[model samples]
Target chain A: MSELELQNKKVAALASTETIDGEIATLNLGPTHPATHGIFQNILQVDGERILSAEQTVGYIHRAFEKLAERRPYNQITPITDRLNYCSSPINNMGWHMTVEKLIGAEMPKRVDYMRVIVMELARIADHLVCNSVIGVDTGALTGFTYMFQEREKIYDIYEEICGARLTTNVGRIGGFDRDFNKEFITKLRAFLKEFPKKFDEFGALLERNRIFMDRTIGAGPITAERALSYSFAGPNLRAAGVDYDVRVMKPYSSYQDFDFTIPVGNDGDTYDRFMVRQQEIRESLKIITQALENMPEGDYHADIPSFYLPPKEEVYSSMEALIYHFKIVMGETPIPAGEVYHSVEGGNGELGYYLVSDGGRTPYRLHFRRPCFIYYQAYPEMITGSLLSDAILTMSSMNVIAGELDA
Target chain B: MSEFANTIKDSLLEKFTKTSYELDGYGEHNFFMSQDEIHPAIEFLKNNGFIYLTDITGSHYPEKEGAEFQVVYHIHNLSENLRIRLKVDLSEKDVHVPSMTDLFAGANWMERETFDFFGIIFEGHPNLTRILNVDDMDYHPMKKEYALEDETRTDKDDTFFGR
Candidate 1:
């Protein structure tokens, strides 16, 4: 080749490099991608096939939930929380209701608390099934994802039997559940308890030992305990880093302290650790559910607060006092004393907290949700910094970021 | 009665003499630090075992005569298994506070969210863009002054999801 031609080619290459330098190539991953579980968008800055930085642009499904809760009555807020993390609606429902109940200083019966535990644990199992299966699917294992989805469908069917709605279930009331779990619902749940453990074992065997699956997740998105904690990561994400801090154990709400279970911790804070922690958690949750059902006390499902909880249908039609109470509760006449309460539940993803401020009115003054995904999403760029683009997707699935919770 | 709350309170109060910090009975510890002491206060918290920076949320209290906004920082310690609240007061005009993103990477989006909702800008945030709200949206929805009714009607036309 001529020397002049060689010089020209070198100059051309330098110009192209300069154009791309310090300008992180922006790539819109989704608002509609299978990898992103929900409608989440990540404006990725890529260098070749490696992701240099990722700016998670959520709010595609932002429901203005906090703002909506402020306008609605305390009981009306349950439906709103249902949409926050739709996959784990029961946990969100219980968390929000518990916060309100705490603010009001309302006490529930032992039976009610046990029921809450059963429902919440069931929700946790369902949530983990989705998270683990999605991680497997992202890592090129689709069969396990489908199998888990079928299992999750059974759980959803149970939810429908208890509450009219499945995904956005406004299940629990302020003090306790809206109604008692009938014989059929209990029967189905008992049968699920019998079947879930075996299926769970099958799920673990399928993906936990797979050579291809292990390669994709073993050391992928490794985060130190210090880094995980520093990033305000919670739930399984923090536990996967070997932190034995489960809110259910540390600060038990809804009679979680009554149950005997172990908090699973992973030594290496990687995708594999996260996946394993979640799988183990499913087992623990199943145990909790079984224990709750076995030890459940028999009593009224809801507290005897006529103003806060709805009166019986028979009483509503029969008496003027019941009618007035019903009207007052529906129109949000029952006073909510001026106070603020911050309640945190160990949600499927991590610590799902609801910080509610009440001005003694029917509606909430300000409701700030401390969403786990929002916190974990911050460590995304750090987790996927030097890894391949595929690893980034896997890391996100393991993170279990629900766009609803993040945006809310 | 937990050692975690007491340890955090003692450590923070000892570190910053002027800052008023208190411990709630339900395991939540609160530290009321000045804007100037926020960086140093957070630095101390990070080093002294408060490793997790869970969330940084802003609240506007226009009714409280002089105080316009209050910013709350929720931090957790993994080893001790404790959660604490660190707060600072900011006026509407000069709503600047030292960014904790340098210490805790998790504070990045949270600080942006505070900025988006209550318009309390983090001075050194790497990307201080609107998170929940759309870009070019002027009003801070969380602020008391921003009318929710006006936005609710307009938001219907702009976005289909009502997020």
Candidate 2:
């Protein structure tokens, strides 16, 4: 084929798949470039400044979590989940814990639930801070970026107080927490509750009203409710399109029913609407944290299921029964019923679901993680089409497609 | 089970004759369908208000007779706040099922991922190729028949880890 004919054939295939009209310039964005946040590539067919079509290439960081989960024991798989959307790993840890608890029929007490709620809300705030501030940085405003980083550090300090690790926190256990929250931890969390919202509002003031930021985001990458629903958009992305569907409200798990908070919704699913929806969601998370702290119940932090929760370390060293229980858990010898369960929580980005199938084994017969970022990123190519190249970056930042979650 | 979920279960049992079990009594339904019956079953559920497709995944069973591969669909009805799981079994020789991309655009990547990991083909899918795995990978990694450890590694002995 001649060169012109080859270009025509390329356009022909692109037109049939992505549907772009007339001739266009092709621009390849990166596999290792900073624009994607995580590692993914976008090949865009552009007509000058306007993007006619975009083709996304993902899986740069695929670790085969499904294949790997088949070999490891149930507890060993917790660390694997921490890598998916590492920005908010507590939700992943707690979501996995609840799925296993459901399988083993372990019921936790109200105190355990409240403590979990507190940790989960803190993770949600950390996730939104990264998203909103990154959106600000994309708009050429750096002040909010640095300001929000400090608040995120406070969240890390809280995580360090609870668990040793911060970013990829493998914190919770199958039935409950490894230990109860100490007085020191509760005090630190209350301090965070008092201090974070003010910094959050100050950061919002920098971008929510700035003229240049508003013009760049108001109409960029707008997705209709019909298309958004058809595409299975969830969390803030779906909420930004005027749909009030939230997993926490529609399907409450982990004692979320006891908490009262409003779901934030937006009129247009544009860049501006997505940012605003997350901003309001941060406020709602603050309200939930305060309520969970005030009405905190008193009981064991973990369920009394010995097979699910490890015995105390001191008892393990002193008592034979405790040592045997510790050995059973460490060696993955606990019994599990043969059944299937699907449990989901309102993750930082959207609905984080774990579909686990157990065949009376210590490990899972089959485990599937229904990551929201993986599902929501499908609409990216469609959303970015007909927008400018720079606006495509803004749309991606708003979507917050962590490469870790995308490739998993 | 919730009232609406049980209602869905009764309706589905009447039509498909598949047994409905209350999984953990958690307001969800589980049932199985033949490969040939899945397209119409999905269409029936969609018409009945299961507007959102939550996920499309595959599970491999190496020893089951006439059901070597299981293609599972997690569908949700946002209006009623209901979720249902429909599983279809296909033999190793014939691992093909009709695609739901026509119904849900979100199934595009999920179907591709299922195809990449489990080697199940979607007959009418517009594009079906390796998604999470490198395009050059020759075999489906999720199949139990495949070795868990990398075959290329030579330094470690298999007996030490009890592989």
Best by TM-score: 2
- Model 2 quality (TM-score): 0.93
Put down candidate 2 lDDT per residue, A53-134, tens digits, no spaces: 6778889899988778877778888999999989999999999998988887788898989999999999999999999999
- Estimated TM-score for each candidate: 0.90, 0.93
Model 2 chain A scores worst on lDDT over the 10 consecutive residues at A2-11
lDDT of 1 by residue, A215-288 (tens): 87998998998778777789999999988877888778988889999999998899999999999999999888
Q: What is the lDDT of residue A24 in candidate 2?
A: 71
Q: Residue A85 error for model 2, in Å? A: 0.9
Give each candidate's fraction of reference contacts reproduced: 0.65, 0.60
Worst 10 residues of 1 chain B by lDDT: B154-163
Candidate 2 local distance difference test against the native: 0.85
True contacts kept of 1: 0.65
Clashing pairs in 2: none
Count: clashes, candidate 1:
2
Per-residue lDDT, model 1, residue A290, is 85
